[model samples]
Target: MRMILMGLGVVGRSFLRTLIEKSPELRLKYGLNPTLVAVADSSSAVQDERGLDPKEILDLKVRKGSLSGHAREVGMRGVELIRGVDAEVLIDVTPSNFKTGEPSLSYIKAALNTGKHVITASKGPFALEMPALIEMFQESGLHLLFSGTVGGGVPFVRFVRKCLIGERVLAIKGVLNGTTNYILTRMEAGLSFESALREAPGTGLR
Candidate 1:
């Protein structure tokens, strides 16, 4: 799939790295080939029709604060980068603001308006504008997938939609914040939440 990625934060970076690591297995097993044509962070955008090098992307992120440090320098923010790319799908893993879903909502709407499929992990747009966004998708016959919205890669949405197709659903509930859960779990085992977060792998709360 030719695609554009809209976020380059920790979650986005981890997704990209995992995609590269599991790509060989993915191609062998599912016949999936995800080529990133463009990527954008908060500051800048970068695009190459031929696809970008994963190593180069990570290296740039490490050396520079954002993807804009790439020599090409597309000079666009999130939504502008969405329009500038020739991608068929957009992956949005930006941070979510439950109060007012500004930029990410706008990004998803613009992508759908341009007839591009969207898969978003950010909770802001989906939670605040689900009715409108779903209506847009249904009317346009396009996809607005949000499997990553609730459980990261747990496929919670897919499981419910596919497994409960004909069943009457009442309610579903589960822990959404892994960090807080981890800290609490450790606290139950006699360590303070802060101590647990400090020792947790890749946790920022420490």
Candidate 2:
């Protein structure tokens, strides 16, 4: 499977590293050879129609603190990468402002226009721009998966997609924000909300 990633921040980088480390196992287990066809960041973009060396991408990130020096085949902008690459999948991890979807929407649109399945964690795109994106994906017959947007490390998205196939969802209720939940729990337990919030980082709230 050919894939193009849209960002290389902390989460995106970690995802790439994990995928690279797991490729051999994935090939043997699933009879699939997943290739990172391209990568884009705020500073630069790189594309190889055949496939990009994952090790080279990680090395560039380690040396440049970004993907600036990975030998760009296109510019840094998301649209440029989306338009130029011919990958089957597009991974959108650009930082989201939550108010305006901005670059995420553009990148998603471009990929869908080019008939690529999109996997993004940009909440604004799914929350506000979902209708339009859904239409585009349906029209193009491509898939859009936003697992991290709904459940960062949890199984909520996968459960909903897979397990909730033909079942009716009567209701959905749970603590969505872990950070806020931790703080509120501490406040209810006698600790000050401020103190609890301040200690959230150490407890892995983020």
Q: Which candidate is the best by lDDT?
A: 1
Candidate 1, residue 6: how far the Cα is off, in Å: 1.0
lDDT of 2 at 129: 80
Can you list the residue pairs that collide in candidate 2? none
Give per-residue CA lDDT, model 1, range 1-206, as digits (tens).
88898888777788788888998998999998888888887778788899987668877987888776587668667777888788899999887878888688989988987889999878888778889998989999999898877664578888888999999999867765666677788899999867897876554221
- Model 1 — TM-score against the truth? 0.87
- Top TM-score prediction, candidate number: 1
Query: Against the hidden true structure, what lDDT does model 2 obtain?
Result: 0.79
**Local distance difference test scores for all models:** 0.81, 0.79
Per-residue alpha-carbon lDDT of model 2 for 52-161, expressed as tens digits?
88888878886877776566556636787787777888888877656778789888889877888998877778766888888878877899887777644565888987
* Candidate 2 lDDT for residue 67: 72
Candidate 2 stretches with Cα past 4 Å from truth are 165-168, 178-206
